[model samples]
Target chain A: MKQYQRSSILVIGGAEDKVHGKEILQSFWHCAGGTSAIIGIIPSASREPTIIGERYFNIFRDMGAKDIRVLDVRDRIHGEDKGYQEYVEECTGIFMTGGDQLRLCGLLADTPLMERIRQRVKLGEVTLAGTSAGAAVMGHHMIAGGSSGESPNRALVDMAMGLGIIPEVIVDQHFHNRNRMARLLSAISSHPERLGIGIDEDTCAVFHHHNEFIEVLGRGTVTIVDAQAMSYTNQGDVSAEAPLALHNLRLHILGHGDRYNIKNHQPIAAVVE
Target chain B: MKQYQRSSILVIGGAEDKVHGKEILQSFWHCAGGTSAIIGIIPSASREPTIIGERYFNIFRDMGAKDIRVLDVRDRIHGEDKGYQEYVEECTGIFMTGGDQLRLCGLLADTPLMERIRQRVKLGEVTLAGTSAGAAVMGHHMIAGGSSGESPNRALVDMAMGLGIIPEVIVDQHFHNRNRMARLLSAISSHPERLGIGIDEDTCAVFHHHNEFIEVLGRGTVTIVDAQAMSYTNQGDVSAEAPLALHNLRLHILGHGDRYNIKNHQPIAAVVE
Candidate 1:
């Protein structure tokens, strides 16, 4: 018999307006199982880990997460420290701060602490959430770096290995504000099998039920680029310095309260309430 | 006990100077066991399948292969045709043409014919080679499309499912001339576990001995991006419109007669002629 497991992920685009209303944070809190949740803030992605870690700590604390703590992992050596594994293992919710994604992956991707966190998430023990760089590292095919523009071109994006929390999708933060549509299109164009999620600033995409459905929240839009049916491209014939031209690419724009079905690649309209 | 099998792939960057000396094609022919080879050409990626297929058919024919056939797979349904499976099964070499990679994948991927090709490759029955768009689909992580540029940025490249002939690598064609360095770097940055090979026009990277070593052949250079030890990137913290900044990314450039060790991520210097 196939084993059933529950895993949840919260991917927030950069600059989520925390002071405005905290709707996104509230969604994350609820996904983490509310007041009884024990949250662990992984600030390894941040250059100033302590400062960034404290910010999330206070936010979660104010949101009624009574048992919230920060895990300050500085390097691969620190991530391997057995002392930190227990904290990650004990948490019902794990929140990763926004910073350099490569820093976070470098410090924790192969460590015991990260392994523990992954194991717990696999076993339905925790809800993992990240914002900006933190959110980018949630997927296996991470958008490590890239510039934003209106036109799709070759060599515009960089990809790196992520934590493998979400294996089938690639997440990009601060979508619309930065005009990342071109780059996102480029990413999906190159790897059509993997879904691309462009989370706008102040918005979040909550993936639940084993990542089958993603519920969008907050003030901004979440753009979905599905290149599975992409038909044409001059990628092979065109010169390197020229702009890219692709046809039959599909795009989906979802806003607050909207839900997306990953299995079917369909969008569900939000309830009017 | 583990199963031991033999498989090989020749990925050529686009615009290979087929007319100049046919050095890259010669390498592929040699790998396919020379005159004794029975080759199959899959022109599914081309909109003009017959034209492209016939082009390779003559090339392989002139190269002294007695048995050369084109597998005109029009769609997913045609790929399921039982008659065509025999051509792919009997061939000692299979060459996929350059056009729309998505077209090739759309028609052949997951179909019975594709499965047969994969089975044959795994069983050491055939040598597979592809150029340009053909080459991109050689790996599991396919570069579907992207524009050319000198710098890496977010969403600058797209990735899709390839034929899975090379499971641990991503192949890009027209490396230097197209200025695809940025996109390839982006790919490796996001998925460091997988190696990235950028084949310049007319160059080919031949994977043999169970993909333990890659032999570079052609006039142009092959760029290998190894991201396993990548240390840092400001991918997450920076604005979406900002260009990428990465540190400690390892790059290797190889020319004719140069070989790369996949396991060690090192380049073997070419022997002085």
Candidate 2:
């Protein structure tokens, strides 16, 4: 395991305004492996990243993190100065502003900006805070919601890959408002090998390194799906025009104050939250 | 495409206490898809399924369902019943009673009972309804969530694989009740080549055959995840002990009463609900 100076992620389902922004920032501050300089990566999609950056920048500023700096990944992805790399080197933490997770990931992907961010996180002492899409992109798979849940056969729905900072989880923004648990579970059940997480609007799941489980914050619930011994093929013998015939999957439920271990992928029975 | 006689599904998301069992049954009945007989599969897992079934069975009975048979997949998975295939063949719709989807699928999977059920669905006219886990297994992948948005570098946490019905859609139940959207999005986004659907409580998404768009029902919203263009890897160079790194992905929003067409494994735009 690569040691991180400060390792923590403040994952919020949505953060358009202040109602949960303060708490979200505090959570990141408390859990960031260690250190203080905060870097915010502003993305241009869905909405302006500057909006959420202001929220975090302000909170971080109050938290004694006066060296907060917002870097536009778009402007820095190819810049020769390695300004992003340099910024990450000196920063105690890095923040990914909320916008379209796809936008943020796209900008940082394969660029020195994301590479340096990864190096900083792996070295420890990088506090990661992302609201809405920012939060969604931290997962191995990111939720890109559209349309409704009429049937599992629609071709219009899909999940985009994200930053992979949190490889074990999949994320969706505005979870409760859009009613996404079903889709998440359905996605997990087919594989029945990956756990699915649903984070509610304005809520956060704080992961502290070496902790057996994560702590849930905010008013709404954080759902869990654990299928340990499941087997089935999603591809049935039916043709393209036929209805889907899926089989063989299971689910275990979890809520706030839950302790889940990644190695075992099973709940650790209750730990002091 | 293998022709189906009719298609319908009973979506039971809410508990009998929170949402009327009768209401769930009525929803199925109204979307009967011309089903005259509905079979309920019940297995012990939690207290809700049985309670719901007992209270709502009469309603379907009142609706003049020719036969409302309740059978245990365990008793019939391997048993040789001369009428087993005929029993399933005679039904216009086979309604799976809600309970532990795993236990139910476990017993019926790969058995003559499941084969019969599969054939019945293939015959089309068979409406399979699953509440909670029942809904969770409809998709090609199912979520067996056990809490791991924190550490994903390790092996998968959930078990997947269920009866093949819905090929691409990943289904999660009680979507809004529990925060599962993020997890589902992660599961599919990690793959970044599939779609995820979260079905809210007391709701259903009806799919019309021939690749037509899916229709929505109930008071809850349905969340969709699309990943037409996502670039990611194994979160390479990251360990199970730290926050993983991710790359690119996108997200789109959807709601209830809206229709989404799945073309090329991505969610296209649809009219708002």
Candidate 3:
């Protein structure tokens, strides 16, 4: 038996070398439930989804994923792939490759692929792993980058729907290097009740169903923006030609090796729920 | 007459103390070219736009806006005041009072009010300014939040439309305190050729004509992320869920009292074309 009753799921932001790939693979392979393989991705939005395609295959191969397939269905309008059934059936674990999250969400929204992934995670028999864009789209809400810090104007800034694997949490990748913290803070400030998670380049944070949190191999820290207790008004519904005002907003930051049990949606002690 | 032509606009972000009743009043009296008035915002998506409403009216009135009027257009659908025409025609400058950006965007997206304002700025007959949410929307692209930096999976997090005043520039207000440098960098990385400008709190960078730039009063520095001459692929368009690899991205930082000119889309010394 594994520590989590449900299938193991590993969510990662991009920069694989920093994401502790080797450590995660070892742990998933050791799961006694016998894992299979399923790969989810926003394939069409990326210019090189095939870049690490072979590495993922190799990892899953070592994890006993005899059959591995990458779904490149950019849209339902394009239809599904051929071996999706076998991949889903034998899927002891599902992996999501990181790329362009917008591209991923574009494909998964109201599509059969997203529906299937939701069902698998619900069944808790499969493991889920995603990196970079893959990890971003897994959550209910995700960060869409906006204008430069030079201008405070918030136009053309929109949010795309996601797989909803994790609700009330918005995620971003390439954090510090990209300096996306302000964008994330503005994001959570728009919705004070939500929590924003930012995994640094090449880092991974795993949340288990049994209430355990583990920091995979990576050099960067995870930045969490929790506006649960704060109050803000983004004027999101206001006209774009006007100024927006916000008041009384607060945030909390979390790091790797930290545990935030989702059951209650608050920062908790570093212990299994 | 104004120095810069249309097709490009400068957007200002917000801060609380910057709106000291006496100072804003002076700005209008000394710097403003025409009659000024204050606009009040009502409830929309977030907090009340009232705080800023009072602040603007008080400041404008104190600054010799004897013809000043508070167009309390809180609810666009239901509460747009009727006395806008006189003010619009008579005023030399337009100040977008602070409120929830969503509400402002909603009320002004297709209304005659936005049309007039756009026309005024296009003709260089009036200056447009905003704070906070008002500032976020003045870009060719807006962040619309939803960007979770935790992972690159959700890169296309979410986006909303803007006034389309400023081209190729995405603005962020209240920068350093919130750490949005990364988000801006991520945004710039998406379009390596584009420029990302992050304005610190209480700071304003005014873009005059097509080539002139000036920094305004503020405590923090302005950040710019320029990604030209960089190599990145498999981003926003990947074949699968692979970690998008970005190579050779460069960043620039600008602070107060610093000015630069954009000649042929490149930042250089302010000069006459």
Model 1 lDDT at residue B172 = 85
For each of the candidates, the C-alpha root-mean-square deviation to the true structure, in angstroms, is: 17.2, 14.6, 18.5
* Weakest ten-residue segment in model 3 chain B by summed lDDT: B264-273
Off by over 4 Å in 3: A1-6, A18-21, A24-45, A62-65, A74-82, A150-153, A210-217, A234-250, A269-273, B1-273
Interface RMSD of each: 15.9, 13.2, 13.3
Candidate 3's residue-wise lDDT over B1-273, tens digit each?
123322224355456354444332244333444244332222232355466556566666655554555455545543334467556666555666555566667766656666666777667665566566666667667655533333332252344666666656677666654555545544554555555666766656566663245433344445555445444333565422223333333333343344544443333322223
Task: Write the residue-wise lDDT of candidate 3 on A1-273 in tens digits.
Answer: 135334556667676562245554555444424353344333444657565565666666666744566665655664355466445655656666766777777766666656766677767766676777777876677665564333233342356666778766787776655656555655564555666777776666666763244333354555555445333333464454222323322222233344455555444322223
Candidate 2 at residue B247, lDDT?
A: 27
RMSD after Cα superposition, model 1: 17.2
C-alpha DockQ for predicted model 3: 0.04
Overlapping backbone residue pairs in candidate 2 total: 111
In the order shown, the chain A TM-scores of the predictions are 0.93, 0.80, 0.77
lDDT, candidate 1, at A77: 83
DockQ for all candidate structures vs. native: 0.01, 0.04, 0.04
TM-score rank order: 1, 2, 3
Candidate 1 chain B: worst-modelled 10 consecutive residues by lDDT: B1-10
Q: List model 2 lDDT by residue over B1-273, tens digit each.
A: 111225655444544223355544555665553245555444423346456565546656766766765553445334345565666666665565556766656656667766666666655557666667667666666665534223222232364776767766666666645555445544663445556666666666565553344555555545555545433333333343322222223332233344556664333322323
Please report how far candidate 2 places residue A130 from its true position, in Å: 2.0
